[model samples]
Target: MLAVSRSVTRARIAARLPIVERTTAGRPTPTRTTKERTMPQHPKGSVLEFDLRGTGSGVLQEVAIAGSEHAVRAEGHPAFGGTDSAPSPLDLVLSAYVSCNQVTATIVALGQGITLGAFEGRVQAELDNSVLVFGAEGDGTFQRLTLTVDLETELDDAAFDAFVAEVARRCPLTQLFERAGVEITNAWTNRALARV
Candidate 1:
């Protein structure tokens, strides 16, 4: 049942966007017509800035925001010559993407007068290690990413679709990946909200 939902979501996304062709490096190269090449608009004074500081040596770092009581420890993977202590930079990036989507979804649901239950997200990425590890001539970004989200909601099929679409449009992290030319697919599963 979940697999069928994912298939439908993928089909919907593919049908709405312009056709994309795969490059020799297995990355997607999107093709758009003149009519479809409009840029997104940002209203005045809408920009938000964030700042953080980190200190580390030998592929391990402790990062924290100013005036915050919490700090995050990050380390490089063992393959990159660092002790496998904490999440690597790439892992943090994927974590940001998932958390950003959930936050955006909560805001969207609130605005739409909807209530949400338990939510979970998973991200799978294909990284081209050749560029990072070896002196490769290609881009080092993830070749592809798949984000699957499971949410318990009471909305119907059409409402769920609209909610998901709106969340995608408003998610800053999603915009970052799309603008960077990363091939990303989002599969959302809307489960029935359990009543207690």
Candidate 2:
């Protein structure tokens, strides 16, 4: 297991960012991590922080978390879009895939002593009934997310393919999807029912 880094500080906090405010009351808001690990989702009122350190290959849309709107602002750069307010959950999912691949690639390449240059990943997912139904066939409720990735790297084809598989194995999103066998947790206050 890689010694993952949890090195974010309050100084690294984008206090003005709306998403930061959404993290108020200790809620984990949605965002990517520095090495690009998308932390598991938390219940409402949590802070989700991601440290983005991807090379400016211009794949991701530039966004900013400025001044307490309680969510990250989609500053959408010229490549993706411009001046959009925020990214939808779907958009974030795609980002999560990208980040996951990047992190996975880094660890896999370094471990194998492979020189990696220009890593890029594109993910395509479908929000349809088939995948969901497949996952929910039994007495479990589940959501299905599938990604088709196009990876560009410098390693040999065989090594790169292995690297991709390795990364996918360790990628947080893939792990959650593969290991999460739908078991919903529902809790609520008990109330007395009056006899009528």
Candidate 3:
């Protein structure tokens, strides 16, 4: 596990940057704790915030969160006239979905007394780019999402099946896709694979 913290304070907002505001009325966002043998407890509610500054070329942008010393660059896809130096926003979305599933699965495994050898998830999506790129008249979104997970463990088939079922049901990313009307195909391989 990894500890994640955030503080809501004034960040340096340079001139000419467009800022989006989201208001929440509740407790401060909870900090995530890591390195414990058990999974971290979930917060009832949390407030997340972030900022992005355009890089002034090819739809590129630099992203950061409050209190973070590092930032990541994002850019539009090359097909849309971007330089393709960094990942497109849609790429980030798919990556986040897979990454979130990996973390959530690990936590579920730890809680279920399952000793995991290795695990990996790959996510891919098909998008209807006409709306964003060619000015089509329908909603621009993913037409389908495919998630494949390779997992290694010593548990019996029944136990592994149960574990996978629980993880699939509890993974927040899966629910997000469902809520967004994106069709998802989930495949699991309960065997070892080359580790990256």
Candidate 4:
């Protein structure tokens, strides 16, 4: 089970917002009867935890959130002589960066009063494994990270650029990459011709 240390009650969170349901046509429609929604309010400065135990040997491990029963397996890269049964830790980190960008960018855009229509993205990272695997002196970090996003919105070109700039500034993963001196690139596509 995943144990989240909630400083606020669930009722308080539920009281803050009405339940919204997606219709068959994929439009968000508010329901007449409000329901207690999971993750209704975002908790700030919350301490998150993850617990993991080695499954057997060979650098394979099973991980679980403290209050959650679900677990996932992780393993070392096959290039390091271990069976590639699951994603490596580095792979997970890369995935986290990608997922974080998507979530943060969308939330920020919505907060900026931009009605989001559709959003899709792809992330790619280039890494040099020689440092970690071959005992090289240099860093074993990502040399470059790139994000390509297709956004369906009515914002004009200037407004779209501004939105993307704000997203890049606000995204934690983007800042992390910047702080770590990693080269990051972003490409965006507007799906709608109408301007706002």
Top model number, TM-score: 1
Winner by lDDT: 1
Q: Order of all candidates by TM-score, from best down to worst?
A: 1, 3, 4, 2
Worst 10 residues of 3 by lDDT: 1-10
- Model 2 Cα shift for residue 165 (angstroms): 1.2
Off by over 4 Å in 2: 1-84, 129-154, 180-196
As for candidate 1, its clashing pairs are: none
Model 3 misplaced stretches (Cα beyond 4 Å): 1-58, 192-196
TM-score of 1: 0.75
Better candidate by TM-score, 2 or 3: 3
Q: Score every model by TM-score.
A: 0.75, 0.42, 0.68, 0.68
Cα error, candidate 1, residue 93 (Å): 1.1
Q: Which 10-residue window in model 2 sums to the lowest lDDT? A: 184-193
Model 4 — TM-score against the truth? 0.68
lDDT scores in order: 0.78, 0.47, 0.68, 0.69
Model 1 alpha-carbon miss at residue 18, Å: 40
Give a tens-digit lDDT track for model 3, residues 98-175.
Answer: 888776766676556555666677987899899988999986878899999887776677877788778778788788
